[model samples]
Every structure is written in C-alpha cells, then in structure tokens.
Target chain A: MINRTRYLTQSVAKILIWIGALSTIAMMILILFQILREGLPVLHLGFFLDSPKNMGREGGIFTTIVGTVALTAVAIIVGAPLGVGTAIFLREYTRESKTSRVIRFGTDCLAGVPSIIFGLFGFVFFVIRLNMGWSILSGGLTLAAMILPTVISTAEESIKTIPSSYREVSYSLGGTRWQTITRVVLPSALPGIFTGILLSIGRSIGETAAIILTAGSSLVMPTSLFSPSRTMSVHFYILAREGISMKMAYGTGAALILLVLMVNIIAQWLINRYIRHRT
Target chain B: MAMKEKIIEKILLLTAFSSIFILGLITFFIFKEGLPLILKIGIKAFLLGEKWIPSKGLFGVFPMIVSSFWVTFGALLLGIPLGLACAIFLSELIPPSVGLLLRPAIQLLAAIPSVIYGFWGLIVLVPLIQNHFGGPGLSILAGSLVLGFMILPTIITISEDSLKALPPTYKAGALALGATHWQTIWRVLIPAARSGVVASVILGMGRAIGETMAMIMILGNAVKMPTSFLDSARTLTTNIGIEMGYASGDHRQALFATGVVLFFIIMALNTLAISLSRRRVH
Candidate 1:
C-alpha cells in the first residue's frame, strides 16, 4: 500500500510539472494567435510603406517605424558608451568597497523603479525643466538613463567573467592598466558588451509610457534629434487606448509583436554566437 | 602615458558615478514637485481620503494604494504556484536539451513588452471576462491574469536558479534513504531553495505592482477599493499612466506625488528582494 501511494504521488508530481510547462507554452500560443488573427488583416505592403495620415487614424506606420529606429539610435549612441564606462569602473577600477556597493545598490534601485516613474522624471527634468520639449533627444536621454542599470550590470558581469590569467599576462608584459583593458580585456569582452547593448536596444524599442510622456507623439517623420517622434509601441498604445482606429491599432500591435520577436531572436543569436565562440 | 591613463580613469569614474547622480536627481525632482502638493492637501487627506478627481482638487490615492496591493497579491496568488512548478520541471524533471529550448522561450515571454500584454488583455481577456462573468470585463481578475503572466519569467528563472544552486548531495541522500523522487523534491530540495523561492516571489510582486500599461488596459481604472476579484480597480501605476498626460496645476503635482508613492513602494520591494537573494548567496 505504501509503495502504491509513492507511485501515485510521483505520477501526480509529474503531471503538475507537465501542466505548468505546457500552460506557459500554451499562453504564448494563445497570445500569438490572438494578435495574428486581429492584426494581420490590416498588415500589408502599403501599411509598411506609407506614413501616417490624419494623426494616425489612417495610413501605415512607416514614419512610426522610422521614428522608433531613430530614437533607438539616439539611445544607443548616448547610453552605450556611458554604460560600458560604468561597467568598466565597477569591474576594473575599484575593489568591493563602499562606493562600489553604493553604485550597485543604486543600479538595483534604478532597475526596480517602474517605467512610468522614469516617465515622470523624464517629463519633468528633460522636457519641462531642461526645455528639451517633446523630442527624440529627450526621449532617448530618458531611455538611456532608464536602461543604464541593465547595461552596467551585464557589462560588469561580462568583464568579471574574463579570467584573470589574461590580465595577469598583460600586466607581466609591462602593459599599463589602460593598455591591458583597451587591447586585451575589452576585445575579449566585446561580444558580451555587445550582448548588453543589444538587449538595451530591445528595451529602447519596446518602451512606451516613458517615451510617450517625454517624446511627444507626433505623426510627422522625425528628421533631427530634437524633432518630436513616436515609437511603434507608443503608437500602438495611443491608438488602442484612445480608440482612434482599431484596425490601425491592431496592425501596429501586430507589427510591435513581430518587432519584439525579431529583436529577441537577434539578441539571442548574438548571445549564442558569443557563447559558441567562447567554447 | 601616466597622464593619459589618469584622464581615462577620471572619465570612466565620472560615467560610473552618473547612475548614482541620476538616482539622486530623480528622487530630488519627484519629491521637490510632489511633496509640496501633499503638504498643501494635508497628509491625512492625501493618504487616507477616498476620492481621486484631479479637476476637483481632490487627490486622494488611498483607494489606489489599496488597489495596487490587492492586485499584486492577486497576481502573486495566480503566478507563484505555476512559476514554481515550471521552475521545478526545468531544473529537475526535464533534460538539459529540452530545458535549453523552454528556458529561452520563458525569456522571450519576458521580452514581449508590457504594451503587447496590455493590448492582448484589452482585445482578448477583457471580452472573455465580460461575456462569461459580467462587469465590463476590465476587472482586477484580468489585471491579475495579465500581470501574472508578465511576472512568470522572473519567478521561474530565479526559482530555477535557486533550485539548481542546491548541492546534489541532499537529493542523493534522500533517494538513498528510500525517499521517492517526489519526496526528494518536496521534502528535501524545495526546503533548501526556500530563500531563493521567497526572493523570486518578492521580485515577482515588484514586477506586478510596477506594471503600468498592462494594468491600465485591463483594470477598469475605477478608483475604489476592490471588494472582489471581479471588481474593477485602479493601481497606483495605472493612475499615473492614465492621468499624467493632461494633468495641470496641483493635479499634475499630485500625479508626481503619486509617482513618489510608487517609487517608495518599489524601493521597499527591491530592498527586500536584494536582502533575500543576498541571504541565498551566503
């Protein structure tokens, strides 16, 4: 009887695990199916080619796509160097001291702060107080700050993962700390740093509430850093929430879904390639 | 050469310190703008009052506080069990080959963006709730469901890491002593990973509470205490997401105050999560 009960319990546990895993997969399928069903009818060549017409009530999100790409570009330009710099400092410059602890703690806090709070700060400091207005520059700066923790942590991790043997070899050759970092450590850690940047790119593209509040959502094609622009996520949000055009909203939503999938795939590919190269 | 190295070091240090400065600046800006309004409205009224009309000079967020807690608690209820189960399966039950595939799939779920989740909830879950149960469909249930899904990745990853971190000796000892596979997992492994599992739940709670766009789309955004799972309720984050666009005067500052409240809550949760995870490491 005891043996039989043990058998029954083991089977029950197995079923529970299967149910959990399958449910996760199932939810993904359900979301994908619903999005494709409602969104694909409106997705077409013209939708991708044409700019918004009548404040996004009609027309494709060509301009919106351009805007998203443009904002992400600015964000990378602004965020990457700073993020990498910070990571280098954390990993290379100092030992595990109070300052390093404080920096890490701050980064963790920044990571946990909701995107909307970031939005409020960006709106107040960047847009209003700094007189940047609702522009791609403002939005990009905010996103850059928002994603700094992610980039810094990942970059720091990558730097830490590089075995100390390489650094010791460089130092033994009479190379200065800077020389060793720039030539040996940095090169070896490039792919990992790049992994962080790519992940940040995905984040910058998908961000909405923060961009919506800071980057004024204009339908016009963005031409300059200071020019106001709207992202695909924000475009989808404004359309769906305001009930401007459900068809366009669905189209944009579908496109947003596809964009996220593409970003995830590309990022994963880079990470995998880096891992394979390491091995 | 020494000068050049020194200059590079200084620059790197400056950049490294920027995040700390930014944190201070954000806290300063939010408080500088928000606290005055809270003072003007009186602390008691702002924290304890029940109304939320900006145009009417009423900026009470007590209902929103209640709503945020309940929704997070609800999401935790829906997400933790499934996430823990999934973690166990990935770490113990499944082979590494299958674990590799499903693992990235979970991360992919995390990367899908909140706006998409909100859109799905709006389009699919809301109507399902409405037709099947009642009350315009945008209830706390929908919020919990969507937010629960949003947080699954975080919970699963952390819990799996915790479980994997356990030394295999415990499992071996249990099995050698005639414990069933299920008993080994239930009696031995899960207890050892307790700190990590608790940390995951706390972190998941943080994500669920901080989520704005999805909650805005699903929760009916009604400013009231949720009496049931089906009741429409507004979260603190959703309140800001919905109103920060056009608010003016004290209304705008009150929204900033709303942000202050949110920032504090998230900070607390982050601290708790950090402490818990730190314990796990030790």
Candidate 2:
C-alpha cells in the first residue's frame, strides 16, 4: 500500500513538473507569436528607410535606428576598453588579493544597481551637472557605465579560462607582460571578448529608461555627438504609451524584437564556433 | 621597454578601479540631490506620509513603497514555484537534447527587453485580466504576472546550476535505498541545494523590485495605496521613471530621494544573495 502511494505521488509530481516546464515554454511562444503576429506585417523596406512623421503615428523608424547605432557605437568604443582592461588587471596582474576582491565586489554591486537608478544619475550628472545636455554623448556615456560590469565579468571569466601554459610560453620566449597580453592573451581571448561586446550591444540597443532620460526623445536626425536623438526602444515606448499609433507601435516593437533576435543568434554562433574550435 | 610596460600597468590599474569610482560617483550624486529632501521633509513624513502631491510640497512615497512591496511579493509568489519546477525539470527530469533546446528559449526570455514585456503586458495580459477578473485590467496582478515571467530566467538558471552542482552519489544512494526519483528530489537533493534555491529567489525579488519601464507600462500608475492584487498602483521605480521628465526643484530632488531608497534596498538584497551563495560554496 505504501509502495503504491509512493508511486502515485511520483506520477503526480512528474505531471506537475511537466506542466511547469510546458507552461514556461508556452509563455515564450505565446509572447513571440502575439508580438510577431501584430508586428511582422508592418515591416517593409520603406518601414526601415523613412523617418517618423507625426509624433510617431506614421513614418519609418530610420532616425531612431541611426540614433541607436551611434549610441551603441559610442558605448562599445568607451566601455570595451575599460571593461577588458579591468579584467586583465584582475586576472593577469593581480592575484586573488585584497585589491582584487574589492574590485570584484564593486563590479558585482554595480551589476545589481538598477537601470532606473542609472537613469536618475544620468539625468542629474550627465544632463545637468556636467552640462552635456540630453544628447548622444550623455546617453552613450550613461549606457557605457551601465554595461561596465557585464563587460568586466564576461571578459574576466574568459580570461580566467585561458590556460596558464599559454602565459608560461610567452614568458619563456622572453616576451614582456604587455607584449604577451596584447599579442597572445588577447587574440586567444578574442572570441569571448567579442561575445561580451555583442551582448553589451544587445543590452544597449534595448535600453529605454536611461536613454529616454539622458538622450531626450528628439525626433530630429542627430548630426553631431551633442545632438539629442531617440532610439527604437524609446520610440516604441512613446508610441505605445501615448496611444499615438498602435500600428506604428507594433511595427517598432517588431523591429526591436528582430534586432534582438539577430544579435542573440550571432552571439550564439560565435560561442558555438569557439567551443568547436577549442575541442 | 620596461618603462612602457610600467606605464601600461599603471593605466590598467586605473581602469580596474573604474567600477569602484563609478559606483562612488553614482552614490554621491544621488545622495547629493536626494538627501536634502529626506532631511527637509523629515525622513518619517517623506517615507510614511500617504499623499504625494509635489505642487503642495508633499513628497510622501509611502504608497509607492507599499506598491513596490506588494508587487514584488506577488511576483515572487507566482515566480518561485514555476521557476523551481522549471529548474528541477531542466536539471533532472529532461533529456540532454531537450534541455539544450529549452535552455536557449529561457535565455531568450531574458534577452527580450523589459519594454517589450511591458508592451506585451499592456496589450494582452491587461485586457485578459480585466475581462476575466474585473478591475481596471492594469492592476498589480497584471504587473506581477508579467514580472513573474520576466524573472523566470534568473531564478531558473541559478537554481538549475545549484541543483546540477550536487554529487550524483546522493541520487544514487537514495535510489539504491529504494527511494523513488520524486522522493529523492523532495527529501534529499532539495535540502542539500537549499541555500542556492533561496539565493535565486532573493535575486529574483531584487530584479522584480528594480524593474521600471515594465511596471510603468502596466501598473496604471495609481498613486493611491494599493488594497489588493486587482488594484492599480505605482511602484518606486515607476514613480521616478514617470515624473523625472519634467519635475524640477524640490519635486526633482524627491525623485532622486526615491532613487536613494531603491539603491539601499537593492544593495541590501544583493548583499544577502551574495552571502547566501557564499554559504553554498562553503
């Protein structure tokens, strides 16, 4: 009787677990289906080429695309160096000492700091105190700061995975520490570092709150670093929030989803290639 | 050559400290703008006062705080069970090939932006709730459902890793003793991975609390204190996100003060999560 009861409990638990797993999968598919169903038909050549007309009720998201590209470029350019450098210092230069521990703690804390708080800081410091105004420069700098921990941790993890023999070989060849890093270490760690950069790009592309605060949702095409601009995420947000144009909102949302999908796919490909190459 | 190397090392050292420096600056600026309001309004009134009228100089965030708490609680209530189950399914129940396919789908859930999730909530989830359950649709219940899913990846990934980290001996020993798979998982493995599972929940709670754009989109931004799951309410993050656009003077500072509270709360949760994970390691 006890054995039968145990079997019954096992069957029930198995069913519940399957339900949990299936529901999560179902949620993902449902969301993607709902979004793409509404969003995909709106996509076209003109949709990618034309700039917005009334508020965001009509026209393509070309300007927002440009703004996104420029902002992400500045972010990657600024963030990648600092993040990779920190990783190098932590992994290559320092042992697991007090200073390294402190740095790691700071990075972890920074990772947990909410994006909205970053927005408030950006609005106050970048937009006001620094007088950079609500421009690409201000927004990009804030995003760079926001993505630092992600870049740092990814870079550090990749660097940690580099076999110690590689470093030993460089030292035996009488290469300087700097020479070894820039030549052997960096090249070997390139795939992982590149993957981190792609991940940061994906993050910067989707960031809305911080961009809206520091970038100041302007419809005009930005001609300079200091010019205010809007991003696709922010544009979709405004369109959805103001009840301006559901059609356009769906289009923009669809576009944002496609862009994220592409980034993830590319990142996945890179990881797979790296793994295969290693093995 | 050695001189150049020395200079490069120094530069790298500066970069290594950049995160710390940035954290300091963020704290400094937020506190600088926010502290005066907390002092002026008195901590008690600012934090506990019910009304949040900025024009009349009333800057109470009590409602927002309460809403944040309830929304986070509701999210965890929905998320924890599903997330734990998913984690267990991934770690133990599923075949490797199936797990591989499902894992990326889960990560993609996280990869999708918060704004998109909110948009989905606004369009689909809100209407469903309104039609089915009553209330204005954009209730705390809607927000929780959306956030509950948004936090699934975090909870599942961490919990799965913790569960996977356990020795196979535990399972083998349980099975050899005639314990079924369910009994082994329920009575043995889960207890062993307890700290990690707890840490995942705590971390998920932090994510739920810190979420902004999604909450702003779905919560209906009602300033009044929330009474139930069906009530529309504003959270602290949304409070800042919605108001900071045009707020100036004391009103602006009040938003920063809200940020200060959020900052402290996130830090506390992060510390707790870190310590919990550390205990698991030991």
Candidate 3:
C-alpha cells in the first residue's frame, strides 16, 4: 500500500510538470489567435501603403511606416557606435580600472530607469530646453539613450566571453593591444555583438512612451531628421486612445506586430546560421 | 612607436569613457526638470493629498500612486505563480526536444510590441471585464491582466535560466535520498535559486509599473483611487501618457513629478534585484 501510494504521487507530479511545460505553448497560441481574430479583417494592401488622411479617414500607414523605419535607423546610427565603443573600453581597454567599474555602474543604473522617465526627460530637455520641438531627431536621440545601456552591457558581455589566449598570442607576436582587439578579439566576438545589436533593434522598434513624448503626433512623413514623425507604436496608441477608428487601429497594430515579428525571426535565423557555420 | 600607440589607445579609451558622462547628463536632465516640481508640491501634499486635479493647480499624486501600486500588486499576484510553475516545468520536467521548441515561443511573446497588447486589451479584454464585472470598459482588472501577460515572458525566461543554472549535485543528492522529483525541486532547487526567482518577480513588477501603452489602453485613464480590482484606475505611467499632450503650467510639472516618483520606485526595485543577484553570485 505504501509503495502504491508513492507510485501515485510520482505520477501526479509528472503530470503537473507536463502541464506546466504545455502552458507556455498554450498561452502563445491563445495570444496569436486572439490577435489574428481581432486584427486580420482590417489588414489590406491599402492599409500598408496609404497614409492616414483627414483624421485617418483614408489612405494607408505609409507615412507611419516610413517614419518608424527612419526613426529606428537614426537611433541605430547614433547609438550603435557609442554602445560598441563603450563595450570595447570596458572589456578590452580599461580592464580592472576604477573608471571601468564606474562606467559599468552607470550603465546598470541607466538600464534600471523606467521608459516613462526617459520620456519626461525627453519632453523637458529635448523638446523644451534645446528647442528641438518634437521632431524625429529628438525622438531618435531619446530612444538612443534609453537603449544604450542594454546595448553596452550585452556587447560588453559578448566581448568579455572571448578567450584571453587569442589576445596573449597576438601580444607575444608584438601586436599592440588595439591591434589585437580589432583583429582578433572582435572577430571572435562578432556573433555576440550582432546579437546585442539585434536585441537593441527589437527594443527600439517596440518602444512607445519615449517616442510619443519626444516625437509629436504627426501623420506626415518626416521630410528631414528634424521634422516630427509618428512611429507605428505611437500611432497605434494615439488611435486606440482617441477611439478614432477600430479597423484602422487594429490594422496598424497588426502591422506593428508583423514588423516586430519579422525582425525577431530574421535575428534568430541569422544567429542560428552563424552558429551552424562556426560549428 | 610604442609611446605613440599608447597615446592613441588612451585617447580612444577617453572617448569610450565619455559615454558614462553622457549617461550622467541624461540623468541630471531628468532630475533638473523634476526636482523643482517635487519641491514646489512638497512631499507631504504630494504623498498624502487625495485629489489629482492638475488643472486647478492641485498636483496631488496620491490617487495615481495608490492606483499604480494596486494594479501592479494585482498583476504580481496573478503572474508570479504561473511564471514560476512554467519555469520549473521548463527547467526540470520537459524533455530537451520539447523544451527547445517551447523556448523560442516564449521569447516571441516577449518580442510582441506593447502596442499590440494594448490594442488587444482595449478591444477584447476591457469589454470582457466590463461585461463580467459591471464596470466601465476599463478597470484595474483589465490592466493587470494585460500587464500580467506582458511581463510573463520576462519572469518565465529569467526564472527558468536561474533554475537551470543551479548545480545539478543538489538535485542528484535529493533524489538519492529517496525524494520525489517534485519534492527535490520545491525544497532544494527552489531554495537554492530563491534570489534569482525573486529577482525575476521584482523585474516583472518594475515592468508592470513602467508599462504605459497597455495600461493606458485598459485602465480607463481615470485619476481616481481604485476601490476594487475591477474599478477603473490610472497608473503614473498611464497618467503621463494620457495627459502629456496638452498639459501646461503646473499640470505639466506635476506630470514630471509623477515621472520622478515612478523613476525612484523602479530604481529601488532594480537596485534590490541587482544586489540580490550579486549576493547569490558570491
């Protein structure tokens, strides 16, 4: 009887564990089904290619899509080099220095700050103080700051994972530290750096609050970096809040999700391909 | 050649070091804009005042603060157990092949933009809550549920990683002592990974509090104190999102102050999480 009871309890525990594993798939499917059910009917070619006109009565999301891509591209352009440079310093140049520790602490603090605070800071500093006046530049720069910590930390980790043997070999061959890092260490850590960049891209594309405050709600395609622009995330928020048009909002949302999903899929594919090649 | 190369390397290092200075400048800008508002409103009135009528020069954030905490607490209560269970399942029970397939799906959930969550919540979740709970189309319940789903991925991923990181010797020892797998997980593995699990939950809490788009979409945007989980509520992030458009004068400053409070809460939670994780490392 005791042996039978033990068997029963073990079986029950196994069942519970299986249930827990399946729950993740269940939740993902549920969310996908719900989004498609709500968003699919509104999807169309015009919705993708046209710009919202006269309070979003007509046209597609052309302007918003362009704005999102442009803003994200600008943010990447501004943030990536700074992030990569900082990582290089932390991992390669400043090894064991007090400045490196301080830099790491600062990056961690920056990462901890919430998105809304960044938004508030952008509103006051970028829009009011600098008189940038709610343009794509302001939005992109604020997002750059918001994502810098993530990029720096991830990049630093990737760099640190490189084996010191390669650097030592180069140094023994009379190579300077900079040459060793650029020629050997960086190549070894390239895949990880790519991963960091992909993650930051994912973050910047999905970010809404900082962009909303810094980039004014303008439906027009930004003619220049200094002009105001509306990202897909911000547009989705504005439409939903104002109860503008349910169909348009849902369509725009689907587009935003599709964009993010595509980026993630591409990143994963690249990482997988790189790993396979390396192995 | 050596000295010249050294100077170039030092210059590059200085440029890299300047990024930290840039981060400090950003933080200083936030404090400079927000501190004056906090000082003007005074801590007592800001913390204790019941009203949040910024239009009338009343900058009371008590309602928003309470509502933010209420919804975040509700979300935590709903999400933590489910996330932990999922983490345990993934780390201990599932076959390797199945775990591999499911891991990407969980990561994809994290990749979904918050706006889509907001849109879905506005169209579906809010209406469902209103029909069942007899409130307006927005409520703390709606916000919490959506926010709970939004942070679910973070909690599950982090906790599962931590659980996986635990040394296998503990589990082996437990099973060798005639303990069931579940008992081993609950008693030994979980206790060993407690700091990591706690960090995951705290991170989720921070995410929920800072989430703007989804909360604003589902929380009814009412600046009133939530009487129940089903009542319409406004979080600090949602408040800033909803009102930053046309707010001016003291009203805008009050929003800045609200942002300040939100910042500190997140900072505290994050500091605790970092220190706890660091302690676990040692």
Candidate 4:
C-alpha cells in the first residue's frame, strides 16, 4: 500500500512539474507571436530608410536606427578595449590577490547597479559636469560603463579557458609575453570574446533609460558625436506611452526585436562552432 | 621585449582599475547630488515620511519604497516556482539535445528589451486585468506579472548551473539506496544546492526591484500608498524615470536621492548574493 502511494505521488509530482515547465515556454512563445503578428505588417523598406515626422505619428524610424548604430559603435569602441584589457590583466598579469579580488568585486557591484542609476550618473557627470550636453558621446559613454562588467567577466572566462601549455610552448619558442598573448592566447579566445562583444551590442541597442537622459530624445538625424539623438527603444517607449501612434511603435519594437534576435543567433552560432572546433 | 611587456602590463593594470574608478565616481556623484537634499529634509523624513510632493518641498519616498518592495515581492511569488521548474527541467528532466534548444530560447528571452516587455504588457495585459479584475489595467498586478517574466532567465540560468554542478555520485548513491528519482531530487539534490538556488532568487529580486521602463509603462503613476495589488502604484525606479525630465532644484535633487536609496539596496543585495555563492563554492 505504501509503495502504491509512493508511485502515485511521484506520477502526480511529475505531471505538475511538466505543467510548470510547459507553461513558461508557452508564455514566451505567446509573447513573441503576439508581437510579431502585430508588428511584421508594419515593417518595410521605407520604415528603415525614412526619418520620423509629426512627433513620430508618421514617417519611419530611420534616424532612430542611425542613433542606435552610432551609440552602439561608440560603446563598443570604448568599452571593448577597456574590458578586454581588464580581463587580460586579471587572468594573465595577476594572481589571486587582494587587488584582483577588489577589482572583481567592483565589477560585480557595477553589474548590479541598475541602468537608471547609470542614467543619473551620466546626466550629472557626463552631461552637466563635463559640459557634453545631451549628446551621443554622453549616452555612448554611459552605455560603455553599463556594459563594462559583462565584457570583463566574459573575456576573463574565455581567457581562463586557454590551456597553459600553449603559453608555455610560446615561451619555450622564445616568444615574449606580449607576443604570446597577442598571437596565441587572444586568437584562441577570439570567438568567446567576440560573443561577449555581440551580447554587449545587443544590450546597447535596446537600452532606453540611460539613452533618453544623456542622449536626449531628438528625432532628428544624428550628424556627429556631439548631436543629440533618439534610439529605437526610446522611440518605441515614447510612442506607446503618449499614445502617439501604435503602428509606429509596433514597427520600432519589431525592428528592435529583430536586431536582438539577429545578435543572439550570431552569438549562439559562434559559440557552437567554437565548441565543435575545439573538440 | 621585457620593457615592452612591462609597459603592456602597466596599461592592462590601469584598465583593470577603471571599473573601480568608475564605480567610485558614480557613487560619489550620486551622493553629492542627493545627500544635501537628504540632510536638509532629515534622513528620517526623507525615508519614512509618507508624502512625496516635489513642488511643495515634500520629498519623502515611503510610498515608493513600499510599492517597490510589494511589486518585487509579488514578482518573486510568481517567478520562483516557474523559474525553479524550468531549471529542474533543464538540469535533470530533459535530454541534453532538448535542453540545448531550450537554453538559447531562455537567453533570447533575456535579450529581448524591457521596453518590448513593457509594450506587450500595455497592449495585452492591462486590458485583460481591467476586464477581469475590475480595476484600471495599470495595477501592481500588471507590473508584477511582467516583471515576473522578466526575471525568469536570471533565476533559471543560475539555479540550473548550481544544480548541474552537483557531483554525480549524489544521484547514484541516492538511487542505489532505493530512493525514487523524485525523492532523490527533493530530499538530496535540492537540499544540497540550496545556497545556489537561494542566490538565484535573491538576484532575481534585485532585477525585479531595479527594473524601470517596464514598471513605468505598466504601473500607473499613483503616488499614494498602494493598499492592494489592484491599486495603481509607482516604484522607486519609475519615480526617478518619470520625473527626471521635468524636475529641477529640490525636485531634481529628490530624484537623485531616490536613486541613492536604490543604489544602496542593489549593492546590499549583490553583496548578499556574492557571499551566498561564495559559501556554495566551499
């Protein structure tokens, strides 16, 4: 009788677990499907080519797209070098010491600081204090700070995976430390590091709070680093919030989703290829 | 060559310290902007006073603080079960091939912007809640549901990692001792991985609390204390996000003070999570 009850309990528990897992997956699919169904019709070539008009009630999101691209480019250019250098220092130049631990703790804490806090800092320090005004430079620098921890951690993890024997081989071959890192370790870690950069790009593309504060919500085409601009995420937020035009919001959201999807797909493919090649 | 290596090392070390330097500057500026207001109003009045009118010089954030906790608590209630289920499913129940496919799907869920989530909540969830629950669609309930989903990836990924990190002998020994699969998971494996699972939940709480744009979209800008999930409310993040554009003088300082409170809360949670995970490692 006890054994019978045990089997029944297990079966019931299993069913509940299956329901929980399936519902989560179903919810994800439903969100994706609902957005795409409403959004795909609005996406066209013109939507990508023309700038907005009439407070974003009409016209396309071309300027927002440019803003997103420029902002992401600046973030990657500034953030990637700093992040990879930090990772290299952590993994190659330092041992497990107080200094390394403090740096790691700082990175982790920075990761936990919310995006809005970064926006506040950018507004005060970059926009006001530094006299950058509401421009792409301020916004991009804030995003770089926001994505710094992610890049550092990913780069460090990848660098840590490179076999020590490779470094030993380089040294035995009379290669300098700089030469070994540049030619051997970094090359082997490229796929992983590249994946991190891709992930950061995706993040920079979607960030809204920091962008709106530091970049200013200008719908005009961003001509230079000093010009104020609007990103797609910020554009979507304003449209949907103020009830400007639901259709344009859907289009912008669709475009943003597609961009993120493309990034994740590329990152996943790279990771899979790297694993396969390694094995 | 040696000299070149030394120079490169110095550069890298400077880079390594950049994050710390940036963090210090962020804290310093936020406090510098915020601390004067707090001192002027008194910390107790700023934190515990119920009113938050910036124009009249009332700058208390008690209601927002309450709403932030309530919304985050509601999110945790919904997210923890779903996340644990998915984590267990990925770590134990599913085949590796199936898990591989599902894993990226979760990562993609994370990659989807918070604004998109906010958009979805606005379009679909608010109306659903209004029609069925008999309240304005923009309630704490709406915010919670959206945030619940937003935090899934954080909870699932970390919990699954901890579960996967367990020694194989644990499962084998439990089974060999005649424990059923469910029994082994519930009585042995989960108990063993408790620290990690707890850490994931804490981190999820941090994410839910720190979330801004989505809450600003779904949670209506009611400043009064929320008595129920049906009432519209605002969070600390939404407060800062909504008002920063037009706010100046004491009002602007008040928003930064709000951010100061948020910053401390997140740092505390992060330190707790790090300590918990460190315990798991040993």
For all candidates listed, what's the TM-score of chain B alone? 0.96, 0.97, 0.95, 0.99
Residue-level lDDT for B186 in candidate 3: 84
Once fitted onto the true fold, the runs of candidate 1 whose alpha carbons sit more than 4 angstroms away are none
Residue pairs in clash, model 2:
none
Q: After best superposition, candidate 4 residue B19: deviation in angstroms?
A: 1.4
TM-score of each: 0.97, 0.98, 0.94, 0.99
Write model 2 residue lDDT over B1-282, tens digit each, in one string: 999999999999999999999999999999999999999989999899999999999999999999999999999988999999999999999999897678878877888989999999999999999999999999999999999999998899999989999999999999999999999999999999999999999889999999999899999998999999999999999999999999999999999999999998999998898888878987
Ranking by lDDT: 4, 2, 1, 3
Output the lDDT of residue A193, model 1: 85
lDDT of each residue in A63-176, candidate 1, tens digit only: 989989988888888888988999998888998889888888888878888889889999999999999999998999999998898789778878888989999999999999
Give TM-scores of chain A for all candidates: 0.95, 0.97, 0.90, 0.97
Docking class of 3: medium
The residue-by-residue lDDT of candidate 3 on A1-279, one tens digit each, is 976787688788777667755775686677667766777778888888888887775677889888888878877888887888788878777677788767766777677677777888888888889999999988988888877886787778768767788899999999987788789988887877777677778888888988989988799778998899998888878777888877777777777777777777776676666656655
2 or 3: which has the higher TM-score?
A: 2
Scanning candidate 3 chain B in windows of ten residues, the lowest lDDT window is: B14-23
Candidate 4 deviant stretches above 4 angstroms: none
lDDT of 4 by residue, A139-223 (tens): 9999999999989988998898889999999999999888999999999999989999999999998899988999999998888
Worst 10 residues of 2 chain A by lDDT: A267-276
Clashing residue pairs in all predictions, respectively, total 0, 0, 2, 0
Decide which is better by lDDT, 1 or 4. Answer: 4
Encode model 4's per-residue lDDT on B191-226: one tens digit a residue: 999999999999999999999999999999799899
Which model, 1 or 3, shows the larger lDDT?
Answer: 1
lDDT for each of the candidates?
0.89, 0.93, 0.81, 0.93
